[model samples]
Target: MSNSFSDMLKKNFNIDLNKQQKAAVSHKDGPAITLAVPGAGKTTVLICRTANLILNHNISPDNILSITFSKASARDMKERFNKVFGDFIKYDVKFSTIHSFAYFVINEYARLKGINFKLIEGNNTSLNKVRILKTIFHDVNGGYVNDDKLEELLNTIGYVKNKMIDISDYSSYTVPQIKNFNIIFNKYEEYKQRNNLIDFDDMLTLTLRILKSNPYLLDKYRNKYRYIQVDEGQDTSKIQNEIVKLLCANNNNLFVVADDDQSIYGFRGASPEDLLKFEQNYPTAKTFYMEENFRSTKNIVSVCNSFIKSNKYRYDKNLFTRNENKRPVTIVKTRDEHKQYEYIIKKLKQSDDLSDSAILYRNNLSFISIAEKLDKSNISFYVRDSKLHFFKHWVVNDIVNFLKLALNNNDVQAFENIYYKMKGYLSKAALRYVKEQDNSISVFDRLTTYPDFRSFQIKNISILKRDFKKLVKKRPFEAIRFIENSLEYGKHLKEYCKKTSFSYEGTKTILSHLKTIASECNSIIGFLTRLDELQALIKNSTAKKNNTVTLSTIHSSKGLEFKNVFMIDLIDGEFPSLGSIEAYEFGQVEDLEEERRLFYVGMTRAKESLDLLAINEKNEEKVFISRFINELEYIMKENDEIPSEFSAWMKIGMIINHKRFGIGRIMDIDGDIITIKFKSIGIKQLSLNLCIEKDLLKAANS
Candidate 1:
C-alpha cells in the first residue's frame, strides 16, 4: 500500500518519497510522531503523505485530520492538494483549526455523556472582561494599566492555557497585585460561561472540559481520526497538543511539522519546547533534517545560522544551498532612529523593489519617522493591515464629510460613500447600536462587544447606523428634500472636492469604488453589508504595491513576506525590550531572547537581503550600529573573517556638530541619516545638513 502510494506521488510531484518522507507517509497507525527540522518540501511531503494514505493505504480522507495555525496556510495546503491530486480525491480531509477540531470533539462527546453541547463561535470577542477589569477589577477595585501592560495581559491569557506559564503564580497575592490578576482570571471563565460566548481561547479550554468529562467521545474521535498531521507544530499550545495526544492515543498515526527557530507566535501561547519533547512521546519520531536553502540568499542564511546556533538542544542540520550569496548581508548601523529612517529611504528610493521593499522594525514607534520620511519623499505606502480600514483612520476629510452629512440628513450619495468607506471594519451589531443611537456603543463599545470584534458584524451595523443617524438628526419626508439641496451636504461635497491631500483623495476614491459596489448592493444597506466583506477580503488578500517603503512592527509582519527586511533598534533595551520596568524585577532576559527570535523573524522574511540596524546615545551623540554587528565583529576578529573594506568602513564613525547642540559623533552612516551626538541632548539624528557640519571623519581621512 505504501509502495503504490509512493508511486502515485512520484507520478505527480516528480519526486519519490525520500527516506524521511517515506517514513512520515508510511508510519504505522501509531500515537504521535514528530518530523523534526525537515526542509522546504515539508508541506509537499505532508500533502503527498495524505494522498498516499487515501489512494493506497485505504484510510478514508474523512477519517484523516490535519490542523494548521493559519487559515492562509490551510488554504495553501488545499491548493497544493488540488494541484497534485486533480481535486477528484474523495477522502474526508478534515483540515481545520485546532480550536475547530476541539469544538467538534465537545459537540460529539459532551452530548453522549448527557452534557448539553453548546455551539460557540470562537472568534466572537466580548469587551465585558476588559471593561470589567478596567472599571470594576482594575480601577474601582485596583487601578488601570497602560497600553503596554494591557498588551502583556492579552499576550499572557493566550499563554496560560498552553501552560507555558502557570496562573497559580499570581494566586498568592490579593487586592491590587498578583491576587488581582487571579481574580480577573477567575472571572474570565464566569463571564464566558454566563454569556455562552466563546473567544478564540475558550475553544481550547472548553475542549479540555469536554474531554475530561466524557471518555466515550474521546474514544470515538481517537478512532475517528485514523491519521492526523499538525503543521506549525512549534505553535501548538499544551491543551491543544494534549487533545491531539488523546485523539491519537498510543497510535503513532500523527505527524507534526514546524521549524523551532521560526516559532514567533510564543506570545500567543505557542511553545517550541513541546517540539523538543516529541521523542519521549513518540519513540519513532524520526527527526529528518531538510538543510537545503530555499528561502534566503546564502549570505543571509549564514549570518542567521550564527545567531540561531546560540540556542541549545536544537536539531543540527546541514542547511546548505547551491544558491550563492549575492552580497554579504550588511549592517547599516544608524546613529539614531531618525537617521535610520532617512538612510533607508535614500538607499531604497531607486531600488527595483522599493515598493515591494520593507523596513522591518522592533516596534510601530519606528514607523513614525519612516512614514514621515516617505511622506516627504512623496512615496506612497499602504500599511499591510490598515490599508483597507481607511474609514477607521482619523481621515479628517472622511470624518468631516460624514459628520456633516449626518448632521444635515440622508444627503444623496454622501451617506453611502461614508458607509461604503466604513463597511470595511464595522460590524452589524455596532451599526445597530449606533443606529439605535445607543450612545452606549461608542468605538469603545464596539471594540469591547467581543473578544475580537468579528469583522462582518461591525461593517453591517456601521453602514446602517451611519444612515439612520443621519435621518434621525434630519427627520421628515420634507426634510429629505431639504437634505437634497442642504447647504451642509453641498458643503461636504464641496469640501470633498476641495480636499487636496492625497490620503483624503484616496478616501474619496474608495467611495467611487463603493458607488460601483453600491450598484450591486442595490440599497445603501445591502451594498454596505456585502461591501464590508469585499473590502476586508481585498485588504487581507495581499500587500499592496506602492512606491512608499513600508515600516511595520514584526508582530504585524507575521504571515507576510518581504523582499528587503530592515531590522532597526537591534540594541538591548529596544529589541529584547526593556519592557515595563515594573514587569521585570531583574530585566527581560526572556524579552531579549524573544527579541532575538524577532530579529530572526525579520531576517527570515527576506528572500534576497536583510539589514540589521541599531542606534544608541553617547557623548551627546546619537550612535547606532547592529548589536549583532558587534557579535559579527567578535566572530571576525576571532576567525580573521572580516572583509577588507568592512573592517575599516564598518568601524568608521563621523561627527556632526550644530552650533547650539555642540559636538556629536556618527554612530551610523546610512545614505541620508547621520547619527550625531550633541553636548546637551546626547545622541540623536541631525537631519543631514539641516543644522550640522561634518568634521571628525574629514580630518581622519586627510
Candidate 2:
C-alpha cells in the first residue's frame, strides 16, 4: 500500500515522501502523534494521510475529520487536498478550524434545543465586546483605559476560558488590573447570559458542555468522525484538547501533528505539555518525529537545532536539512540601533529582490525606527503587523497637550486634556468651573478662582502655572524632561498605575521612546510633525504588499519563509524581554523557554541566509547581546569538530578563561587585536583569531 501510495504521489505531484513522513501517512489506526519540525511538510503528510485513510483503508470521507487551529490553515489544507486529489476521490473530507467545528456542534444542538444566543463578538453582533469591557473597566476603576490594557484584559479572559480555569480561581493567574478581576469576569459572563449573547470563547466552553452533557450528541460525533486528525497540536489549549479527546474516544484513531519546539503561544493558554504527555492520554499511541527540514539551508538547520537544545521541556529531536549551505549564519553587531538600521538598509540595497528579504523583531516597536530608515532610504517594505497604538497612547496625548498649554496658556482645550493627568488634583467639577470662565485667561489661573478649592489645591495650581511658563522657553526634549521630573507628571503616572494596576514600566518605556523621538526634533512643532510623518509612513508601507521587503514581529512571521532573514534588536532586555528574564530568575523557566522558541522560529524562517543583529549600546547605555545568541555560540563551539580560526562570540565585558592567564574579562576588540584584563596576569593583548584557533581562550561559565 505504501509503495503504491508513493508511486501515485510521484506520478501526480512529482513529490517523494521521506521515511518519517511516509510512516506518519501510513499510520491509519489507533492513536498517534507526529512531532513535525518546521518546514517538515506536516501539512502535506496530513493531506496524504487523509487520502491514505480513504483510498487504502476504505474509510468513508464523511467519517474523517481534520481540524487545525486557524481558519487560514484549514482553508489551505482543504484547497491543497482538493488540488492533490483532483476528482480522484468521490467525496470531500471535512476540514475545519476547532472554532468552526465547535460552532457546527453548537448550531446543531441549539436548533434541536430551541436555544437562541446572539454572538457579541464578530461583525454580526450589535454589542461590542470591547465597548462593554471598557465600560465595565471605567465604571469600576473610574479612569480611561488604553488599548493595551483593554487588549490584556480581553486576552486574560480568553486565557481563562481556554484553560478552563474556574472564575473562583481567577486570582491564581497573573491577570491584568482589576483587583476584583473575578467581579469583572463574572460581570462579563453575566452580561452575556442576561442579554442572550455569546462570545468566541463561549463557543468552545459551550460546545464542551453540550458534548459532556448529551451522550447521544457526543456519540453521534464520535461515530461520525471515525478518524480525527489535528494540526498544530502544540498550540491546542486544554479545552480544545478535551473536545478532540471526547470525539476520538470511541474509535481511538487520533493523529496529532505538532512540534513542541515551536510552541510559543503559552500566553494564549496553548500547552505543549499536553503534546508531550500524549502517551499518558493514549497508552497505545505511537509518536513519529519528522525532523527533516525542507526549507532552510543545512547551516541554518544545524545552528537552530543546536540552539533549541537549551530548552529543557521539549522532545529530543534534531532538525536537519538537505538544502545547500549557501552561507554561514552571520551575527552582526553595531554601535547602536541607528547603526543597525544602516546595516539593514545597506544589505537590502545589495539584495537582488526586496521581496525575498525580511526584517524580523521580537516586539512591534523595534520596527518603528527601521521603518523610518527604510522609507528615508526609498526602500519599499511591508509591515506584517503595524500597530499605531504608541502614537495613539494617552501618554503621547498628555505630553502634546502639555506642550500646547506651554506654548499658549490660554489654550483651554489643552489645559482640559492634561489638568487631570498632572500633579494638580483637578476634579471634574473644577474642570467644569474652568470651562465656564473666559477663554482669554490661563485655565490654571481660572482653576485657582474656584470657590470650593482647598488651600493646597490653589497653591499647586499656582505652581503648575509657573511650570508651564518655564516650559515655554525649553526645547522639545527638555520640555519632556521638565514635565516628567520637575512638574511631577511621571509621579502622577506612577500613582495612576498603582491605582489602576496598569503597567508602569510599559508606560515609562513609551515615554522613553517618545523622548528619543523628541531628541531628534528642535521644537514641539517638529516633534509633532515627525510623529505624523512616521505614522503616515507606516500606514503607507502596508499598501506596498508586493515587490517589497517584509517587516514583521516574530510571532507574525510564523509559518513564513524568506531568502534572507534579519532578526534585529537582539539585545538582552529587548529580545528575551526583561519580564521573561525576571520570570526565569524567579524559577519560572517556561517564559524563557518560550522566548527561545520564538528566536528559534525566527532563525528557521531563513531559506538561505540568516543574520542576527544586536546593538552594543542603546541610548548611550551599554547593553549585552541576547543570552540566546550567547547560547547559540556555545552550541556552535561545542559542536565544532575543528576549532574555527575566528571567534564571533567575543564582545566587550564578556568574561573569558585563558589557558595561561586564568580568568579574564574582554577589555576591547580592535580588528584582530583583543585586550583582556586577566585576574592573575594583569592586562594582556592577544590575537583574537589565534586564541580561537589554538583553543587558548574559552567563555567563562556564568
Candidate 3:
C-alpha cells in the first residue's frame, strides 16, 4: 500500500517522497503525531495524507477537516489540495484556522442553546483593543491602569483563558499583578457578554463549553470530522488542543504536524507540550519524526540542529539536509550601527536578487534605523506588518524628544524636533540665540539669558534642567518618574488628545512599551543608549519605495523563507533580550529555553546564506554576543578584515579545557573573542589569540 501511495505521488504531483515523508503519509489509523523539522515537506505529507484518506480509505472529503495556524496557511493548504486533486476535490472540504472552525461549530448549533452571538472585531490593533478595554473598565479609574498595564492584563487574561482557569480561582495566580488583572478581567469578560459579542479567544472557550454541555452536538462533530489534521500543532494552546481532542474523541483519527523546537509563541499561550505528550493525552496515539530538511543547506541545518539541541523541552530529533553547501555561516562584526548598515548594503549590492534577501531583528525598534540606512544607500526595502509610526503621536513625540535631549544634551536633531513641536514654548529669535552661543555651554545653559523667553517658560526650563541633571545620575525608573512629574507629560497628552481627537488610550499604549524598556535598563545612560537605538530607527517619512529589502521581527518571520537572511543585533542583552534577564534571575529555565527556540526559528528561515551580525563596542568595557550562538561554528570577519577559519576549529557543545577555568563548553563568539562556560570558574570571555598563545584552550574534537 505504501509503495502504491509513493507511486501515485510521483505520477500525480511529479515529486518523490523521502523516507521520513513517506512514513508520515502512510500512518492512517488511530491518533498520530508527526514531529516535523523545518523545511521537511510536512505540508506535502499533510496534503497527501488527507487525499489518501479520501481516495483509499473511502472517507468523505467533508468528513476530513484540516486545521492550520493562520488564514494564509489555510489558503495555501486549500490551493495545494486543489492543485493535487483538481476537479475531484470536494467543495465541502474544510480548510480553516482553529478559531474559525471553532466559531463555525458554535455559531451554527449555538442557537439551540438560545444564544445568538456576534463576534466583536477582535482583529483591531493592540492600541485599538486597549481603547475598548478603557470603555469596559472605567470603574478602575484612569482607564485601566495605563496602557502597558492594560496590555499586560490582556495578555494575562489570554493566558488564564488558554489554561481554562475559572475566574473564581484567582488564588491560583502567583503573580500579584495578574491577581489584580483577574478582578478587572472578570468585569471585562462580563462586559463582552453583555454586549452579545465574543473576541477571538472566546471562540475557543465558548465553543468547547457549548460542545461539552451538548453531548448531542459533540457527537455530531465527532462523526462529522472522522479524520482531523492539525498543522503547526506546536503553536496550539491548551484550549485549542482540547477542542481537537473532543472532536476526535470517538473516532480517534487525528494527525497532528508540529515541530516542538520551532515552538516560539509560548508568550502567546502556545504550549508545545501538547504535541510532546500526545501519546499521554491519547493512549492510542502513534508518533513519527521527520528530520530531513529539504530547504536550507546542510551547514545551515547543522547549526540550527546544534543550537536547538541545548533546549531541554523539545522532542529529541536530529535534522539533516541533502544540500552540501559548506559555505560557513558568516559572522560580521562592526564597530557601530552605522558600520553594520554599511556592511549590509555592501552585501545587498552583491546579491543577484535583492528581494530574495531579508534583514531580521529581535525587535521592531531596529527596523527604522535599518530602513533609513537602506533608503540612504538607494536600497529599497519593505517593513512587514507595518504599524503607524511611533513618532507620529504628536504629543508623545514632543515628550520623548525632550527626554532624548535630556539624555544627551548634544542631540541637536532631538532639540530641533522638540523646538518645532512646542510652538509657544520659545520664540524663533530666542532659539537662534541659544543655537549661536559658545559651543561649550549646553543648550539649556544658553537658554538662561534669552531675552525673548517668557518668564513662565523660563521657570519650566529651569525645573527641566535641574531635574534632568539629577536624572542622568539616577536609576532608569527614577529618571522616568522625574520626567513624568517635571514635564507633566500626561497633562500634555490630554491637551493633545483633545486638539487632534487622538485616542489617548492608544498614545498611552505606545508610551507603555517605551516605559517597559526604560524600567528594565540599569542606569540612565543604559536607558539613553536604548532610547538612542530606538530613535535611530524612526520612520523616515520622505522615502517611500515598494521594491526594497524586507525588514521583519523574528516572530513575524515564521513560515517565511529568504535566500539571504541577515539577523542583526545578535548582542547578549538584545536578542534573548532584557526580558530574558527576569526569567534567568527567577530561574525560569523554560522561558530561557523559549528564547533559544526563537533563535532556532530565526536561523532556520534562511535557505542559502545566513549572516549573524554583532557590533564590537569601541569605548565599552566589554563586548558580548548572544550565549545562544557561542558554540556554533562560523567564520568571523571584522570590518574590512579578511575572513579567517578560526571558528572552524571550535564548535558549540564541544568540551574544551581552559587554563584557569578547567573544562567547559564553548558558548559564543564575537570578533576575536570566544565565551565559554566552565565548570569551575563559571562563564568567562577569553581572547582567541591569547587562548592559543597560552595553550589555554583544547577543543574536544581535537
Candidate 4:
C-alpha cells in the first residue's frame, strides 16, 4: 500500500479492491496462490497486481509477464490494462498465453541455435497433424481410422505429452485399436525430428529441453521476467506448471490465481493436484482465498457452494454473495423429455427478454430436440457450440443407409455404405461382384451368387433378405428399432465403441435421440426430410447473431453468466454420466468430481433465477434425477421429511403400504405424483409432498 497507487486505481479504473484482493495485489514477493471463487473478479485482482508491481514497487514493465488460459483472455487482459493505465504508463507490459510464451521461447532458442523448425500443428501449418496421425494409425493397426478413433488418439497423445509421461509408460495408457501405441508415438516423434517438424505439444517439451539443457538461456529467461502472474492456474497442465516453475526458479515471485473446485479439465491432462500441492513445490508460498462471488444471487451462491462440497478432492472454501435472493433455486420435474421441452418453451414465451436467459446441458445431444422444438415454435436462439455432428454421425448414416436399402433392395449405393457395418460379412471382392450383377436383383440376394462366399455367408445373406422384406413395411421409428435390434446394428456399434475408445453411452444416447426424431415421421422419406431440416435449422441458428436465448453445453457456458439459467436433462446418466458413476462406485472418484464441478459451474452461472430440470421418464424408461441435485437438496436441508433414499424407493409398479390406505401397488409415477391401486381404496394419486409430510407411504417389504 502506497496511497498514490491506491488513488490511481480508484481514480483511473474506478475500482475498489476488496481486502483479499488488496492482499493478493500487494504481495510482490515470494510464491503465492489465490483461491478465487467463481465471479470473484480474479482478473481484476491480477491486472491490479500487475499494475501494483509497476507503479508502487517500480518494477520494470518489461520484466513482468502475465499468463492467461486463452488468446482471447490474453487480449482482453491487455485491453483492460491499457484502459486502466495506458495514459499513465509509457511502457507496455507483456501478457501472453502460456503456449504463446512457449512458442516465443522456442523461437528465440532456435534463432540462437540456428535451428529451423516447421510447425506441423495449428490452422496455419502446412502439415496436417490429424492426417499424419491417421497414417501412423493405419500403419500400426492396419485398419481404417474413423473420426472417433482419430480424436481419441490425438487426445491420448496430447495427454501423454502434457502430463510429461515417460516413453516407457505410454503402453499403460489405453489407446483403442492400437495396442503398441508407443510405436506410433515414437515413429511420429522420429518423423518430426527427421523433418525438423514440431507440433503444439512439442512447444512445451522442446522449450523445457532447451531451458534445462541450456542453463544460459534458462537464466536469461528467469532474469528477464522477474514477476509472473498466471490466471486459471487450475487448468494448467503439469508440463506447463513445470515450465512456470523453471521460469520463476530464481525469483520465486510466482503468483497463481486458481480455484481447485472449478478444475474440470482433467481429460486435457490438467492437474489440479499440482495446484492442491502448491505448498510442497514452494514451501514458502502463501495461500489466499477470494470467496466472495459478485455475479450470483445469495441463494445461487449458497446452493452451489454446498453442492461443490460433496467433492472431497477440492480445497475447502465457501462462496458467499451480498446480493439478495430473488428466488429460491427451483427443481422442476417433468413427466418426460417432451414435457421438459414444453416447460422450457412456456417459460421462454413468458419472458420479456430472451437474451438474459440460458438453457445449459451436459451433453451436446441434449440440445437437438429442444433446438428443434424452439425452431418449430418460432423461438429464436443462439447455440454456443452449434455442432450438428449427431446428424452426420456414422451411426445415423448407417441407420439411414439401412432404411434406404429396406425401401429399395436394389440400392447398390446403400449396400456399399453399410455392408461392412452389418452382420452380412460381405468383402470388397463380393461388393465388386454384386455391382456387376443385374440391376433389378436385390444386393442381399445377389450376394449369395459370389463364388468365394462361404455357406454360412449365404445363409446370413438369405436371413438379411428376409429381414429387409419385413423391415420395408415398418414405419421409420420401427425401422430404426429394427436396424438397432433385429438387424444387430446396435451390436456393431458396441463393438465399434470398444475398438475406437468412443463413448458407448454417448453413442446410444445419439441413437436414442435419433429414434425420438424418427418417432415423428410415418415414412422414411419424411424422416430423412426432417433430419435435413433439423441440420439446417441448427446450422442457421448460429448465424442469426441475435440477442436471443442461449443454448450451451455447460463446458461452453463457463466464464459466462445469465440472469436466468435452466440446466436441463439433470438426470443420472446425462449429467453425472454413467462412466463417472461407475468409476465412483469402484473408488476412482476423479471423474465423478469433475462431473460435480461441471454441475456446480452450470448452477453458478445464474444471477437471479436457477432451475434444475429433470424427467422421471425418457423414451418410456424410468430415469432418476442427477445425484448432484439430490446432494445439493440434502446439503440445503430443504426436504428433510423426504428420506435420503427416496429416489431409490420411488419406482413404478412397486408394491407399497400406506398407513391410512393399507397395502397398495404402485401403478405409475410422474414427477412426484405417485398413482397407486390400493386394495381398500381403489386407485389414488398422492403427491410425494403429502406422503412425506404425513408419513403415509412405505415399501411393503420394508
Candidate 5:
C-alpha cells in the first residue's frame, strides 16, 4: 500500500521493484489492470502486490485468491510466493486455475444444497458427451454422423459455453453452426443431468448459477476472497469475466495483469474485448503499463512491437528491452523444405548449445520431414501429437489414393499404392506386364489392354472404365460409387478394420464425407483438384516439437524464451494459416487479429536472434511470404535462388480465380506484367503482383 512495502520487498526478496512495477504493487484498492508486456516482470509484480496486501494492508491470507491460466502457472506462482515471502504465506493462500477454483466453489455449494454431482474432467468426458450427441444426431438426422462433424459440434458447444449463451437461445443466433450446437448441447446437458455428472464447463456455469441464485453464498465467496488477482486476464472469456466479477462484488479488491496484444486465444472463445472494456466494467479501475521487456534483445523486441503495432484492436504499448545492439531480425529465403532443413542442421552444428535454438513452425505437418531428418541425424527433440497412427490408416490412405488417381490418370504414386494394397485381386506380375506394355498409360487403363489379364481383373477394369466414362457425363458421385463397388473397397475395408481393430463405423463415416464432397463437384477432375487442395490445407494446419534444436508451433512456443528462434514456414497460407485472411471474407475480423497476435507471440519468443523463413513455392504453386514480413522494419536477406524482394511469390503457371472472370491459370509473369487464360473470359494480360495487391485476383488454391 506504500513505499515501505517496497522496502520490505527489497529487504526480504532482494527485488527492487522498477518504477512501473512499484506503481502496480502499490495500487491496493478497487479494480486495476497492469498492462504487462511480454517478458515484463508481471509475476514479480503479482507476487509482490499480493505480499504487500497481506503484510501492509493486514489482509488475511485466506481472503487472497490468485487465479492464473493453467495448473503449471498456479504452481509456479505458489513457488515464487514461497520463495519471496518464505514463512509468511502459510495459511490458505489460494493459488489455482480459474477452472479449479470454480470447481471448488461449485462442489462446496452442491454439497450445501445436498446435491449429488460428479465433476467430470472435460478431456475424459468429451467422448461421453460426443456419444450422447452422436446418438441424438443419428435419431434426429436419420443416421448421419462423423468425427469431423461431431468435432464441429463440440467446438460450437465450447463457443456457446465460453460466451455464456443459453442452449435454448441458439435459434436466435445467426450462425447456423450455433443452432446445430444448441441441439447437441440440450441433449448433452440432459445426458449429464441424468448421470449426475458435471463437465469442466459446468463447473464455471454452475458456480456462476449458484452465486446468482443464492445471495448468501455469493456474499460468502465475495467476502472470502476479498483480494483477487487474475493473471493472463487478457485471455478471459465472457463467462470467466462474469464469474470473477461476482466473486469480487463485495470487496472490489481486484487486480489483473494483461496485455491485449498477447491475447491470441480468440479462436478458443477467449476475448481481448474483456480486457479492452475492463475500464467500463470497473469504472473506477486504474490502468498501469509495464513496457520494459527483460527477455528479448532490443532489436527482437522492436520487431515484435512494430509487428503488433499494425493491429488496431490492442492497447497502445511498445515493448522495450534492456539488451541493446543485438542482430536485427533476419528473413531467410529457402528453395524448399529440404533446403530449410539443411539450414537448420547447419545452424545446429554451428550453435554452442542446442537448447538455445528453436525451429518454430505454423503447424506440425511442416516438420514431419524435418523431424525425420533430425531423427536420422540422431538429434533429440520433443513433439506432442497423436500416436493413433491415423496417418497410416489403411482405409483412409486407400481412399485418398483413389481420389488422387481420379485427379490424374498418370499418377504413378497412386497406381503403386493401389497395386500393393489390392495385390490379392490385381497381381504384381500383371501390374508389371501392364507397365511394360505401356508405361505412359494409367494402370487402370493398361489393365484393360493387358494381354494376359484375368477375367475377374478385366471385370474390375471394366467397372472403372464404365465409371470413368460416366464421370465425364454424369455427376462425380457415380465415379466414387463405382470405384467403391467395383473394387469391393467396403468389403476390403471391413477386413482391414477387423485386422487392424480400426472402427468399421469410421470407414462408413469417411464414405459419407466423400459422397458429400462428390455431390458438390461438377466433374471428377474438379472434385479431385478441390480435394487435393483441402488435403494440403489440412496438412499445413497447426498442431508442435521441443529440445536438440527446439521444434515448435507458434502456439506452443508462447511464454518461452529462446537464444535464437527460427520461425519457419512464414508463407501466407501457412503462417497466417489458410483461414485467417478468409475469415475476413466471412466477416470474422477477430480471427485475423488473433493470427496477427500469434505471429507477434512467435517473434517475441526470441531472446537474442530471430530468423523468419519462407520459400517461394510449394507443390508448384507460388507461396506468398507473410505480410508481416514486409511490415518488419528490417532488410531481408535474399538468396541467389529467390528473386529480389521475394518476387517469385507470384509465379508463372500459378492458378488464379477472378471473381468476375472465373478460374484462370497464369501463362507468364514478366516483372509486373502477367498473362492469364481464363476459361470464361479468355486470355487476359494484367499486372501480376499488383493485381493481387488490388484484390483483383486471388490464388484459387490459397
Candidate 6:
C-alpha cells in the first residue's frame, strides 16, 4: 500500500495520521486485531486501512463491512473515508452498528431458512417486561402484594439483568423450587411474545439462538461477510462474541479494534470476559499492542501505570508521553466528609486554567461540597449534577420546602399537604382538627407533630415514614408536592395580610415562579437553596453557603479528568468499598478488580502529575499510603529511584487497650467513637466518648 492510497488520502482529505496510522496502513497482509486506547487515532487507522485495501490490496470495498459502536462513530468513519479516498471510493463499502448488521444478516437469511420473525425495536423489550410485571403484581411499585417481597424481586431482577445473566437458564428452573422466579421470567417472555418487541440484549441473544438452531442461516451470513471489523471491542457483549465467532470461522479475515482498559460498560451488560477470552477461543489469533500515548505527560502516565499495574489480569501495556512533567497530583486527607468537600471546592476555584478539571465521585450527589463553596464565593459552575435542584426558592427546589415541613418539624404544612393529596383517607377527627389549627407550618411539619395529630390517630408511623422517604427520592417532584400540600393546609397566613393574604393562589404563584427559576438554574442544588430567600423558607433553611473544599469517591469522578488528582480512601472499606464484600470475609473478585481499574482510570485522567492517598488509620482523616504503595515502590526502586515509606499511611486509633482497660476494638469507627470491645471488661459502650484518634503512622519496615 503506497502513494496510490497515500495520494488518494491527500487528494480527498487531510488527516494527520501519526505513527499508529502509518503502521496500520503499512501492514500488508493486515492485522487480525488492533487495540486502541482513548483519544488515539483509531478512526484514522480505520480509514487509512480501508483506503489501503481499496488502492493497494485491490479488494472491493463492498466485500468489507465495518461495524462501530455508535451512529456518531459510523458518521466519523464515513467522513474519514470520504476525506482520504475522495469520490474514487464508492459508498458500497458499508458501515453499520453491530446490531444493525445483525438485523440485516438475520433478515437476509431468515427467508432462506423459511422462518419469518419480525424485527423488533429495543425499547419494546423493557416496556413489555414492565407491562408484564404490572399485570402479574397488579401494582408495579408493590401496593397490592407483600411490599417487601415485591421490592426484593424487583431488585433481584434488576441485579440479574445488569449482570447479564441469561434468564433462559433461570427461566427453566424447576417451578417448585423457584416458583416466583419462574412466574416473573415466564411473564416477561410472554409479554415479549405478545408485544413482538426486542431489547438491545435480545438483538444479539436472539440472533445467536437462531444461528445456533439454524446453521445454514449462519453460513449464509458467514459467506456473505468476507471480512468484518469490530470497534470498541471493550463494550462488546457475550452475545456479540458469539456472532463474531460464527462469522469468523476461518479466523484469517477478522479485525478487532478495542481497549480492554476502557471497558467501562459492565453496568450495561458488557463483559471484560469477552475480550479476555478472545485469544483462547481464536487459538491462532495474532495480537499487537499500542503503547505510545499522545495524551498526558510522562508523570501522568507513570501515576496511571502505577495504579493500573495493580489489576493483575489486565493486558500488559504502557503509556508514555514526551511532554515536560508539570505539577504533581495533589493528596488531601481531611478531618471528615465536610473537610473533604471543602478541599474539592477550593481546587475548583484554583483550577481555572485547566479546561479538563472536573469533580468526580461515586455518588452523583458528591458535588455537594463544590455546590456549597459556589454559593459563598459567588463562583459560577455548570452544576453538572443530574440528581436534584438544590436551591430553595427555585421551582425544582422543592426539597427545601419538603425539608422545611418534615425535617424542621413543621406540622401544619405537612398535614395540609397530606390532606390535600388524600382528603378522603382522613377520619372525622382529622377534618375537625384541621379546622382548629393555625395553618402556618409546612405540611411535613404539621403531619408529623400536630397537636391534633393525636386526634386523627393512625396505626404504624411506618406508612408516613415511607411516604416521606418516597418524597426524598424525587427531589424535584418533592418540591411540587410541598407547594400543593402547603397551599391545601395553610389558610390563615395566606389570608392574614388583607392587602396580600397568603391564599392558596398566592402560594401556587410563588411556587410556580420558583419552578421557573429552577428550570433556568445553573445548578439544581444551588437552585434548591434559592427558596431560602423567601420569608416562609428563610426560617427553615439551614445549609449555609461557605468556601468549602470538595471531597468525593473516585467512582463519582468518571468522565471527569483533572490537572491535579487526589485519590484517598484507598482502604478496605472505601476504594474497596464495604459494599464490595460478598460474605463477611470474602470479596467479590470482580468488584475488587473493577475498583482497581477505576483507580487506573482516575490516574490516567491526570495531565502532568498524580497523587495516591489512603486513610492512615482504619478510621481517621490522616492520609497514608496503601499496601500497594510497596509494589509501586519496588518498580521505581528497581530503576534506582528511592522508595517512599509506608509509615505515611498508618494513623493512630482512638480506642486502645491498657493493661487495666484491656484490649478494646473501636466500636464506631470515625473521628469519635463511644462503644468498644474490651477483652478484660466484657463490654463497654460510650456516647460522645473520650475515645480519640492520634496521628501516628506505621513505619515502612514495621
Clashing pairs in 3: 368-537, 369-537, 380-548, 380-549, 381-548, 381-549, 630-667, 630-668, 631-652, 631-667
Candidate 6 Cα lDDT to native: 0.52
Writing each residue's lDDT as its tens digit, candidate 3 over 340-376 gives: 6767887799876777888998866567556656755
Scored by lDDT, model 3 comes in at 0.73
Q: Which whole-number lDDT from 0 to 100 does residue 187 have in model 3?
A: 79
**Per-model TM values vs. the true structure:** 0.64, 0.86, 0.72, 0.86, 0.70, 0.61
lDDT comparison, 3 vs 4, better candidate: 4
Residue-wise C-alpha lDDT for candidate 6, range 1-702, written one tens digit per residue = 475556555665766555655665566442355766544557777777776776677877776778887776787788767765666676566778988876776676667666565544323544444344556765333444332244345555543554546676654421122235656655765766675555445566667777778877767766776777888787676667777777767534777887777776554556577777768877666675556666676655665566566666667777656667545333433344444444444555666543445444443333433344444555544433233322322222233544444443345544443442332245556545654655664333334554544543433233554555554444553444443453332233244324431234323434433444344344435455554443223222233233322333454443344565555434444454444433324644665566556656666656554554434442122434444444544554443332221112312334455334656654443222235566777666642212211222222233
lDDT (Cα atoms) of all candidates against the true structure:
0.56, 0.84, 0.73, 0.83, 0.71, 0.52
lDDT of 1 by residue, 1-702 (tens): 366666756785687655655666565455444443323567777777677777766778878898988777788888878777756585446567887776776666556666653444322534544554445447424656534344456556666766634566644321123325656676765766775655567678778777666677667777777778898787787888888877777475777877776666665766567777888877766665555556677766666667766555455544545567554555554555556566666667758756567777765544433553565466666554433333343332354345445544434334334543432444455344445443433443343354445666555455545554654454232233233233233334446535522223233333333333333333333433553555454454356665646667786775466667777656654555544222345653444454556676677677676666656642123433545556654543444333221223333365434555655566754333456665678878644323212222232333
Candidate 1, residue 486: lDDT? 36
Q: Give the winner by TM-score: 1 or 3.
A: 3
- Runs of candidate 5 exceeding 4 Å displacement: 122-127, 130-150, 166-180, 384-396, 399-547, 585-588, 633-702
lDDT of 2 by residue, 156-241 (tens): 99999999998888777754545556778888888888877778899999999999999989999988899999999988999999
TM-score for candidate 2 = 0.86
Task: Point to the candidate with the largest lDDT.
Answer: 2
Clashes of each: 39, 0, 10, 0, 0, 57
lDDT of 2 at 651: 65
Error of 2 at 432 (Å): 6.3
Clashes of 6: 57
After TM-score superposition, what is the CA distance of residue 25 in candidate 3 from its true location, in Å?
Answer: 0.7
Residue 359, candidate 2: C-alpha displacement in angstroms: 1.9
- Where is model 3 more than 4 Å wrong at Cα? 87-92, 122-130, 143-151, 168-179, 392-547, 617-623, 633-702
